[model samples]
Target: MKITGYRCLTTQHDWGRPVGDVNGHVDSGITEVPILVLETDAGIEGVATGSTHDVDRLFPAIEGEDPRAVASLYDRMIARVFKSGHAGATFGGIGTIDAALWDIKAKLAGEPLWRLLGARDRYVDGYASGLDIALDDERLAALYGSMAERGYTSGKLKGGRDVADDVRRLRIVEEALHRNAEHPGLMLDANESWHRKQAVRHVSAIERELDLVWIEEPLRRWDAAGHAALSRAVRASVATGENLTGLEQYRPLMDAGAVDVVQIGAVWGVTHFLRVAVAAHARDLPVSLVGHTADAAVVHAAAAVPNTMPTEVQDLGSPIGVTIDQAFQDGGIVLGDEPGAGIRIDESEIAARMAGDGWRSAAGPHVRSHRTGLRLATERTA
Candidate 1:
């Protein structure tokens, strides 16, 4: 079927609790969710989560092409944005269309995306990530305890501030996960808030008291040398690359041996994740799928890969107006027999909530504080 046109919809993910990391948070615990719908001439439509800055500029690349030609269309879109650079929102835009194209391809084949991609089982292993830096101690325990009850044997906490507090909070997560497994895996995300020596010192102190599986984004995402140094200095594996937009961005880190666990963000679409996973596997490295806010479509791609460790489970529910054909059980995500990526959107529900619920704060988690790396630098020298 040939691609026709597309439309965008607005929705929101209500966490019902605060969600943030070292940067900051929305006190209301709500954020906007953008959905893209690709209309095809063969009476089939494909849906994807997240949006790019400009649809007009990118749509022409795939306008009359076959949606089933996903890889070629994806490459064409990248080339379309070559001079301007497809980083940030533009890459996300390319990714949004690419994800929708994959959905269409799978649906045309009359099989779930995972099955079409040759996965033996529909189950993808998962770990809980609360984005809980803004949450208090009582709430933290409650959230993780609930996830443990859902059979999650691993959990990642948000922390990069004080060593004493980080240690204390990590134990809380460990205790929560201990309810499910004897040696539950625990991870920490510094969110690119620490410098080299600072990340080493902080993570080293926590390692003395706890057995960490990994420490994520300890330094900046592009700091190949710093990440490699941190990887050698600490017992926990260094995991990063959730913020990177393309394959080229990951080459430096891979060459430097900086990342022990390669991470692919769900928002970057299926093609990018699959390519990156294969690249990481070629070098004998394990890859992990990072979840986006209320989006888990990439789990299908993750299941098709052999070296996938555990995909992140950021939320138990989906955004308003969205329904996913998957269930979380046995400490993993089980994809249903849905013919596509398993996401269905209700336009009426989104239209009703579009007016008031989807607003984001200007100073949200995406913005880093001026004192983020500076405070740790001062401490390291002192």
Candidate 2:
């Protein structure tokens, strides 16, 4: 079936508690989920529930083409924006379209995406990540305790600003996950809020009290040398790459032995994950899937990849009008036999709740504080 056109809409994922990291938090615990629907001439439509910006510029690349040619169309989308570069929103648009195309392809084959992607098993292991910097102690414990009850044996906490506070919070998560596993996996995300030296010191201090599995985004996304140095200095594995948009951005870090766990964001689409997972596998590095709300599509890709670590579990539920044919059980995501990614969007329900993101707070975590990186200098002088 040939691609005809696309439609876009916005929905919301309510975390039920404030979610944020070192940078900012959404006090209302709600964030907007962008939905993309690719219409086909033969009455088959593909859906993607993530960022779908810049479609006006990128759609022409795949227009009138067979959706089954997902990879070629993906490359075409990238090449379409060659001069402008595919990073931020442009890459997001490509990722969403690519995911929809893959969805259509799998639907056409009359198989679930994991099966079509050659995965023998439909289960994708996951770790609970609360993005809980904004949550209070009681709320944090409640959030993770619930995940533990769901059989998650690992959890990642967002922290890096205050070492003492981070240590305390990590202990809370450890205690929560301990209900499922004796030695539950623990991780900390600095969210690119710390400098290289600051990362070393902060993580080193936390290591004194906890055995962390990894520390994510300790430095900026492109700091290959700094990440390598930080990795060498700390015992916990350094994980980055969530903010990176393409394969070329990962090469420098891979060559430098910078990242121990290579992370591929779910928002970047299925093709991107497949390519990155293969590349990371060649280097013998473990790949992890960064979670997004309604991330089932990429989880299918994660299941087919041999090098995947536990994917992140950000939200336990779907947006208001979206339903996913997957179960969060056995400490992971189990896919249904439904064709494609198994995400069904109810346009009427979405229209009824047509609320734009109301979680807007000027001082929230979404806004990076002015003193974010500069504090490293202040700490050194003091």
Candidate 3:
């Protein structure tokens, strides 16, 4: 079916609560952006992109293209903007449009996007990603101690500041899990806050304290050579690429032998993720899907790839996967047999939240953190 129209819906929601780590106090907050929806002639509409900027500019690029030509359309968009940088807000815009096109195509074909992507299996495994980065020692241990009871055998912790303090935090988490015989696998994310030397020093200490499965983006997103050197120096497997856009950006990391695990976001759309997956598979690298708080779309994409290791289940503010209509069993997430992405947005709830004055009232003062240089500013409600 042909494309009919596209619309942008901007709304706000509390993303997550704060958790403590070794570095200091850390919390999660909400930022507002437009979610793109694509409508087709066959009376099928799909949620294309979630929380993206520049919806106005992306509308004209794929307005009349066939929904099934998602890959070709993605190529066209990339070629049209090839001269532009592949990271940051511009690539994020193109990613939104590409995702919408896939949603429309899968809905039209009357099959789940995973089936369309040639997935041999229907379900994939997942890991529990906690949000207790701000808790003290006692509270942090209790938080992870409870997570083991809930059947999460793998977990990720946040780090970026003091090396010794971070090691203490990890020691507590490991001891709590070890007491129960759960022996949960652990991963760490630096969020691109450290330099090469600092990452090496801190991650080496972490490896000694905890049996880390992987260390994610300890340096910067663009540090291919440094990642390679660090991978050689540390025992923890190097994992990165969550902030990356396309296959071209991914190639250098692979060629450099930098990353041991590749993390991809489905919000970039099915076609682009699949392209990256195929390349990663060629190099025998394992893949982990990154969550943008909401990740049902990526759940299906991750299951289809044979080399996919585990999907990251973030314990953030609101439970998007649990609240939505899709089926989540055990620690793994499963998509419905419905066509397209197999999920629907609750438009009434979205509208009500948008119309209310809650978000405007919740907008707090902006505070910048010294460690990550991230400004935790309250976004204006529109």
Top of the candidates by lDDT: 2
- Please give, for residues 62-118, the per-residue lDDT of candidate 1 as tens digits: 999999999999999999988989888898888888888988999999999999888
In candidate 2, what are the lDDT values of residues 220-302, reduced to their tens digit? Answer: 89999999999999999999998789999999999999999999999999999999999999999999999655977899999
Candidate 3, RMSD to the unseen true structure = 5.6
Which residue pairs clash in candidate 3?
16-317, 19-132, 19-133, 19-134, 20-132, 20-133, 20-134, 20-135, 21-133
Report the poorest 10 consecutive residues by lDDT, candidate 3.
373-382
TM for every model, in the order presented, reads: 0.97, 0.97, 0.84
RMSD of each: 2.4, 2.3, 5.6
Q: Global lDDT of each model?
A: 0.88, 0.89, 0.67
TM-score of 2: 0.97
